[model samples]
Target: ATLPGEQLFEQFTKGLELVFGDKPSLGFICGIKEAVREDGATLPGLCCIDAPYQLDEDYWGSEYQCEVDDGLGSLIPNPCERISPYFGKISEESCKVYGGTYCPLTDCTRLQECVAELIDIARNENRTAFANYLLNAPNITDPENSFQCGWAREYFGFPANFINDNQICEDIKQFRNSRDFEFLEEFFNQGSSSDEPGDDDDNFNVVPPLVLVPPDPENRDATEAVSKKAEVQNGQAWRATNFALESAAKTLNSIYDAIKDSKCPCGGPFCVAGDICKLVQNIAQKITVVGLILIETSAEISKFTYGEVAELGNVEPIQTGERVKAIYDNMVLTGNYLQRRFQGVNDYLERMENRLVRALAPPSAPGPAPETVASPSNPNITFVVRNGVGCDGLDQDGDSVEDNCEEDRFPPSLRLTSKASTSFVCEVDYCLEERFRTQTEAITFLNAVFDVVDDCSAPEFVQKVIEQIPGTVCEKTRFEIIPVQTFPENSTCADVTLPGISAIVELGLDTSAPTVLCGFQVDRSDDDRRVSPDSKTLVIPSERKSSFVDTLLFQTTADNCPGPLRRMVTVQSNEFVYGTNSVVLINQENTEDGSVVPRLFVNPQSCADGSQDDATICDPDPVSDFRFYEVKISVTDAVGNEAVDTCRVIVEPSRRRNLAKQTKDSQRSSSESGKGSKKIIPIEELLLKVAESNVRYTLATVTSEVSPSPVA
Candidate 1:
């Protein structure tokens, strides 16, 4: 017979295959077995054995009844009777030995009770044991069983079961070595021991060893070494790759530099090395062939050419190719190319080399020639002036001699004549007699004479002579005289005249012929005399008039008059005199001697004294100078030329010492008469009284005339 534990274990294994598949790991499968074992009694329990065969009614008595007992007494039977009853019955002695003296039925009842109690104990103990087992279980490694039976999988749906077998064990080992697991185990064990009922030292009980595993030092060392080697290998690979790239770049740079620096026989540095070398070789071959040809041709040309035409005038022939090549070689070595053509090289180099050769070579010499000097061979004709004569002199007729015969005459003559043979004589008296080839020469001679005597200073006679010479004189030749005149003192007059007087006096001018006098007067004065009060001469105070003269003189020239001739005249009166009985006419021309014949006459009867006095008094001429005698003279020329002249005489007061004296007796008589004349009124008072009397008489006359006739 199978034990319940074993049967349940089998059932769980089968269920796991159906639910989770595969044989689970031992730890998790064990946990599942324990859970099932604890709950085994609760799952509807199965019978241990099948039921017995049922009895048929044919084999039983017709009246047989199926009675059943409520307890084990009915299920068990008595076996003491020896009557050979049915095969199912047992004797009483057999019942006592097999079931006990209580009978089979009672024994059977007791056995059933014991089995139920054992089942109850097994379930309760298994549940507690299963929980403990799972808490302490090792990690499961099987995928299916771990997923189906682990606490996390069972309660939640965590697929801890999905962890690979090796990884699960690794984690489990890591957890076991952790301090947390160790602490948990120690703490739980101590608590379990403390809960023991009768143990005094249980609190101090030693905890079981926790299953914490220590790390494997050998594996750790192996892992570190492997990781370090991998990192170093990777670094080395990167460095090697970078170095390879750098080397490649350097190689490329060198190639570029070589190409850039290389010179090509062609124009530029664009060709590769192989191309440049080929070009150089080909050029050399061509140059060699050209040099040979040039040399042969040059020899032939030299044989035929010679002299100046070949050397200078003609273009020189270029040598053939071979000769040119030979020259190029020689020039490359010694640098000379006088007779060669340049080709197959750098263009600039060819040009430069040619220029150098030309510069270094000597120049060619010139051919021969002739020389002479030039001069003139004829003498120029010249003319000379005789006397004042020149080429322009007049001859009146076509004859060359001047017509007029004066002692200082300029004899006309002709030296050079024009080829036209036309001759004419100058008719002018002062003409130049010498002939001139050019008018400019004649003009130059005349200008010299003009410089000596210009028109403004030349004499008028000389100007007239020049003007009357027909066309012989230059129009610009004329004479002018500037008169500078000064007038005589007191000779100027305005409204009066004197015999033998001219309006304008000629000075330093030609008076041999009549001429008009015209010019402005400067600094003129009308007074006859100028007085300096500081001098002893008495000044006659009077208003006088005078003017400048611009006049014409008939039949006379300015030379007849003296230098600084008087052009005007003035008349003036003497100063006032005082205390004279009568004004006298002294000499008007000589005031100091008073001896001139009087030109003025006045009757003394016309004066207040009615006396014929010869002197004037200040009382008679108080308004001005006391010249009482005035003479007015009328002049008539012998040819009926008429004019007037006036003279004045002044008589001044007598000195006080020259007065008549009175006698002493006469003075006494006059004093007495003055005393007796008190009754007589003074003349001024008598005049006043007479004026008042006249005024009253006139008033009475006016009143009577104005009033009505009294009682007519």
Candidate 2:
């Protein structure tokens, strides 16, 4: 549970200065209100703390007075004063007692800007790591936006509420009762968070405020009762979350059932509904898994028989926060996708309904019959074809010419081709006869537009572009995203060198990408050959972290390209093969040159956890006779040109931990050979001893019984 934004920041900032022994030069999350982002989606509250605002020290400090103006508990300073500027290096006074240094962040504005950039980068992943960095960053000018420092928490005292029973003195309790503690109970003690969260979302989520008031040490019963109550409450909340997740899963299954049971003329495995059901099932299963993880993580926070909130301690409140964040993020993504899908389904159903309504309509009495010609289309009514782009085999442009003419080539640079043209507008309109039946439609035309379809048929971008297009005749619009591939000419796969580090490094990406008339292909390699399940190379989707090929970067030089795709280096190794995360022997002799005019790539696969799976390939320790692997890199340009090359990877090797232990064992064996060593005892002797002991035990039992009778 957390307090409102303003109150949360106040407490957090107070903890920093009051507990951590500093003048508090950070934390300016002032305004808490809903903010809309550029994408038109309304997110959480915006915290424009970096922007200049009138500092209201009196408002927060209020009449609630404290005995001392000291520590993080000191009055909130002016907006500018919230940050202290320093330059050059960390001063000795700024260093931690045990010795940790931080470059003073004197320029508050610059620091905030840098921090914001970091937060943006983290929005997609691992925000906790960035938060930890900001919590204890060194004072330094962040021109490049990289701030990292290590310091022990011991350097700063725990917050007043965070301190244990022994640490809280009567004087401190009295001071807290009179001052800062008032706000923790009443959220703001003044105002609440903004209901409309903006683009600059600052976790405006409302949670139960902390009920912090030191218990009477002498009143043991009251303390135990409070502790028990808290334990039960926390457990209840956790259990409720689990129950909600189960309910959601059941609901999704129910939805899938409805979709499955729906009538469809076509029948194969699951008809048209199977794909949707599969997607929903995947999301439901994952949601359940993440929910279970969230519950388990929250439960592990305390093993206390009763309860305690003495300090943050090993209690990873951040993890709990992140788990919620992950859940929300996944749920949002899945919900959005499902919504779009259902919307498409609704549109199709609506079209069908309109058709049926038209079919059943009453005819006009004694209308004049117009002269009609026996044409392929319905000649009863005059029809003029509208102009539009086309890729499918039909005169979509309304020109007398058939499929050969692609009137408005999109990607304007895409040329007409005999086969595999990937240039089509997101949506286009053309006049058609009422007699036209959807069943007569080609697989690509019907499947690609307004229906869940294959990538080649519809592609990912078509729907996006189509949605953005306005003022279109809804009945005639056709959507498709096509990127045509042309044969490559004079193309060369450049020799590239990548940084050999545990960190992800891009291979000479800027210079090494395939250069052709059209765009190129870049993919991860495996076994000295280009990584491709089919003839077409896999296109890298997004930037990812890896020791080797993170993604295959594909670019089309045609008039239309979907912006630049970022690439991350995949850690290549030989040992961590076949998805096994274990130390294993390397095949030193399996070296092959896959340079057939076609390039070989050394694309190594990674474990789900993003670690190099092959322990033998990239061993970190020094060992003699290191083995190298080859990878084939190949690219087929937008124009039918193809180029391939082979690259070698020098995988670092390590002697397994067993080597040192084995050496010690050998030395001990040699030493023991000269000294007296015990011989191995046979099992027959042990069996005889066991038999003798059993007989003695029987005799003793009888004697004891007889002796006991003497008392009687």
TM-score of each model, paired residue for residue: 0.13, 0.19
lDDT of 1: 0.25
Which has the greatest lDDT? 2
| Residue runs of model 2 more than 4 Å from their true location after superposition | 1-292, 295-712
Candidate 1 to native Cα RMSD, angstroms: 69.1
Tens-place lDDT per residue, model 2, 1-712, is: 1011122122222222211221110110110010100110111111111222223454353322212244687643232211111100112232221122222222123333444455454444323322333333344343322221112111111111111111212222232232122222122121224345333223322332222223346766655655554433233333333343343334334333433333212112223222322332343334334433432333333222113332221222332333333232222212222233334434444433333222212223232322121223212211111111222222222233322223223221112223322334322222221111122232233223322222112233222111212222223323232333221132121121111111110101111123222112533343122323332333211112233332232222211111122211122233233333322211112226311111223333222222344343433212212223323333432222333443333322223113333444556686787543333222233233323321110000000000000101
Cα displacement (Å) at residue 272, model 1: 93
C-alpha positional error of residue 255 in candidate 1 after TM-score superposition, expressed in Å: 93
Model 1 — which ten-residue stretch has the worst lDDT?
697-706
- 1-712 per-residue lDDT for model 1 (tens digits): 1011122123223232112212122222233323233332111111111112112334232221223343666532322212110101122332222222221111112222322343354244332221222343333343223233343332211123222222223333333333332323333243334445553321223333222122235555554444444432123322332333233233323322332333322111222222323332233333233333433333333222211111211222232333322221121211111111112122323332333222212222122211111212112211111121111122212122321222112222112223222214423213233333233443443333332221111122122111111222221121221221121243232222112111111111121211222111212242322122221121122211111121111110122222221111122222222343222222233457432222222222212222323354423322322222222333221112223332222222221111111233345566887632112212233223323321110000000001011111
TM-score of 1: 0.13
